[model samples]
Structure formats: C-alpha cells, structure tokens
Target: MIQWIIPLAFICAGIIAGLIGEKVIFKKLKTFVTEKEVPGSDIIFQALHRMTFVWFVLAGFFWAILGSPVRPDIANAFQKILTIIFLYSVTLVLARLTSGFVNLLVRRTEGVPTSLLSNLAKIAVLILGTLILLQTVGVQITPIVTTLGIGGLAVGLALQDTLANLFSGFYLVISQQVRTGDYVKLDDGNQGYITDINWRNTTIREISNNVIIVPNSKLASAIFTNYHLPAKEITLTLNVGVSYDSDLELVERVTVEVAKEVMQEIAPELIANEPYMRFHTFNDFSIDYTLYMRVSEFFDQRIGKHLLVKKLHKRYHQEGIQIPFPIRDINLHGN
Candidate 1:
C-alpha cells in the first residue's frame, strides 16, 4: 500500500504540472507560431505538448519506482507496456505529420485532385501503423499477409465494375480530358457542366439546374464532347423559309444584316466577324435558306440563334418579305 501511494502521488503531480504548463507556456507558443504563418505549426505544437506531458509522467513514475525492491519480471513487463504506449503515440504523431505534408505537396501541384491524394496518404499511413502495431504485439505477419492476398483477390473479382470505374476516374484526371467546370455532352444525351470529379463518378449540373451523376466507367466508354477544351467557339446556324416569289439576293442580304444586328444587340463579344446567309434548298412551298454565325461560347450559341431568328422575323415584316408557312397539296380522284 505504501509503494502504490508514492507512484500515485507522482502521477498526480505530473498531471497537474502538465496541465499548468500547457495552459501557460504552450498557449503563448501557439500565438507566435500563428503570427509567423508557418505551415502545420499548430499540429507540431500540439504533438510537442502531448509528448512533454507523457515524458513528465514517465519520469515521475521511474523516479518513484527505481529505489523500490521491485521484482525483475514485473519491472520488465511494465517497461514493455510503457514502450508500446510510447511507440503508439509516436506513430500517431508521425501519421498526422505525414498527412499534413502530403496535403501541402498536393496543394502546390496543379491539376492534381487533393481529395484523392489525401485519402491515399491516410490509407498508407494507417497500413504502416497497423503493421507496426502487429509487430509490437509479437504477432506473426505471415498468416495475415496470406489472408489479405486471398481476401483482396475475392474482393477484386466481386467488385470488378466498381474497380473499373475507380481506375477510369483516375485516368480521366491524369489524361486531362474532362475537368471540373467543363461543359460536356455525352452519347447518352446528357449535357451539363462538370461540378465534381470523384473516384467512382463525375457530378454534373445541367442547364435545368438538376444534378447528374455519371459513372467513370460509363464516361470512359462513351463518346463525349468537351466544349471548353480544343476551342471555346461554337458555330450556330439558323434555318429560315420564305415565299419563292421573294427576291433571293435581297432576302440573303436582309437575313445577313439582321443576324449581324442581333449579334451586336444580344452578345457583341460572341459575334465573330459577320454572318452569311446561303440559299440552301428549294422546298415544296418555300425557299429554304441557312444563316451561319459563330459565337464565343457553346452556351450562348442556342440563345444567340433564337434571338437572330426573332430579329430576322421582325426585319422581314418591315421589308414586306413573306415568310411562307408549310403548304401541303392534296389531290383526290373519284371514278
């Protein structure tokens, strides 16, 4: 009972001293570190504070027990337990530091996804820590290694599609084919701007404001168009029909002028040079013509075309040019 009392007193004193030191000393240290703008200094200070507390407790225990006529076996067991605890604390600190370092490195690089890199770093650290813990416990790793290999194989076979998508997602990021914020159109008729590219799927926001999740496997397999890359310019065409009696040259000129004015009115930055109207096809009831123009962005292409058509309609009315509606000729013979 006397021996236990000394050890308990030492532990209590160490705890009180640690609490006072952390509150008084380390709090000031934190302010200095923050003022210096040193990266990951807060984590370093936290780890140091914990280690100092641990050291104080260990020192107190050793001082209290060293003079006692303790059993050699009991002393060795206690030492081993203490060593294991210390190693585990060190491992935790190392893992945290490594994670912070990897995150910093990831931020410095361009086009690398931080989420994926951070996850990988964390997993690597956890695996290393697990191995260390197993070794510390005197457990043979041969059986564990064999079991993991077999289990991994089973999992691979069972989750082939999921794995494919995961790998495909990585490839997509590395290949730089489609990145976040790019407008894309898939073969399945899904068109949207990419919001996030994750390990399993890419999230897109459609023009209608609905979110679409596309699996990486499907994105890899399908033919898709990225409007941002290669070029930002998109060509827009407007098809119009007029009465055959309308003068072809006059109609073409009027349509081109209308397109130019519409582009200037709605999207002056999108307009590329001037528009051209071609008398394309002679339809059953009207002369079909096409107006071609270029816009700065794919999103504006549709709206600009619509505005051009509206302007053309108004202009044609002012010019007294007739836009013919569809006319079907039906003949019936009775015998």
Candidate 2:
C-alpha cells in the first residue's frame, strides 16, 4: 500500500495538471490566436486541440511508471508501451500537420485538387512514422521491407486497372487538364461539374442534382470539352430569321441591342464586345443569320438564349419586324 501511494499521487497530480492546462492555458492561447488572426494558427490549433490533455495524462503515467516499485520486467514493459503510445501520438500530429499544409498550399494556388494531395501527404507521413515506430520497438524491418517489395509487385500485377486509374488521376491533376470544379462534357454525352478526383475515379455533379462517377482511366482518355478552360466567359450563338420584306440593317441593329441587354443582365463585365450578327443564308421565305453574344459561363448560355429570344420577339413586334413562318410550296401533280 505504501509503495502504491507515490504512483497514485503522481497520477492524481497529472490529472489535475492536465485539467488546468487544457482549461486555462490552452483556452487563453486559442482565444489569442483566434483574435490575432494568425496565419497557420488554425492548423496548429487543430493539430493540438484535445491532444494537449492526452499528453499531460501520458506524462503522469510515465512518471508513475518510473517511480513505482514494481517488478523489473513489468516496469520495462510498461515503459515500452508508453513510449510506443507517445511515438504514435507524435506521428498522428505530424500527419495532421502535413495534410493541413498540403491543403493550404493547394488552396492558395487555386489550381489543383486538395483531397487527393492531402490524402497522399497524410499517407506518406503515416508510412514514415510506422517505419520509425517499428525501428524504435526493436522490430526487424529488413525482412518486412523485402517482403513488401516482392508482394507489391504481385499486387501491382493483379491490380492493373486500379493502378491505371490511380496513375491517371495523378496525371490529370498534375497536367491541369481536368480540374475540380470545371464544367466538362465527356465524349459520351455525359456533362457535369467536376467535384473531385480521387484515387480511382472522378466525381461529377450534374445540374440535375445527380452524380456521375467516371473512372479515372476513361476520363483521362476521353475527349471532353472543359467550358471553364480558355476562360469561364463563353460565346453563345442564337440563330434567327427575318421575313424577306423586313429591313436588314434595322434587323442587325435590333438584334444586337437585344443581345446587349441580355449580356448586360447576365455578364455586365463582358459588355465591351458589342453583340453582332452575320446574315448567312437566303432561305425560301426568310433570311437566316446567327447572332453571336457573350455570356459568363456555359450554364449562363441557357438563360441568355431565353432572354434574348423573348426580348427580341417583343422588340421585333414593336418595330414591325416580321419573323415569317417556314412556307414550302406544294406542287400537286397527278402521278
């Protein structure tokens, strides 16, 4: 009983210290960092949050183990266990820090995807930590390394498709072709916004609120149009025809004015380039031409076309511009 007293006292002291540190010191530090708006403070706080209490408690246990008058072998085993636990906790912290930094870097660049890169960073840290842990525990690592090397080859051969997708995902990210958040239409007619690129597949969220899971290999090889690339603002073409009796100059002017109105509503910043039309055909009843307008993005084209058509129809009616219906002459021959 006397021998246990010191250990118990140490444990109690540790618990009290952990409570005070967490509730007082950590709370003040968190408040200070938040108020200051320090860069990387969030990441540091996240890595350390709730972990400081565990550290203090672990310290108490370590001291208790050291001071206890227990059997030599038992004390040694306890020490080894504590050491392993502490090392693993350190490893976890490192992994979080690495992942946090990776995500921060990607966000700043605004080009690459975050999930896959952050996951890879965390995995790398964890793997290195595991190797260090095994070495610290006096485990033989040479044989394990050799076995993994051989087994990896076998696994690679077995998982060809999986590896292909994984590599393809990397290529897509590094090449900056198919990025997250870009609106893309695949050659197969599936169109959506790229939500994420993961280890095996790319996730696309369609406007219909449905998700499309495209395998990385297929997406990499497919011919897809990225409306987000070359710029988000895109050119929208609306073809209209006027009656042959209508004024051609007035037609172009009115069409352009209507296009400018729609463009102003949809993308006012892009109003520098005035809308224009080209008369392309002399049809049987009406002259056909295409109206070229600019909109902010691919999806905006829909609303843009809708507004242009409605407003043009109204304005044309007000101006007495006749949009003639298609008239085909029927020859009645007794055959």
For all candidates in order, the CA lDDT equals 0.77, 0.90
Q: Which 10 residues in a row give candidate 1 its minimum summed lDDT? A: 109-118
Task: Give the candidate number with the greatest TM-score.
Answer: 2
Tell me how far the alpha carbon of residue 60 in candidate 1 is from the true structure, in angstroms, after superposition: 16
Cα lDDT of model 2 by residue, 1-335, tens digit = 99989899888888889898999999999999899999898998888777788888889998999899989899999989988888998999999999998888877776545478788889999989988999999998889999999999999999999999989989999898878878999999999999998889899999998999999999999999999997878999998889999999999898888899998899999999788999999998899999998888899989999898899999999999999997678999997
Tell me the tens digit of each residue's lDDT in model 1 across 186-231: 9889999887677688898999999998898899888999997876
Q: How accurate is candidate 2 locally (lDDT)?
A: 0.90
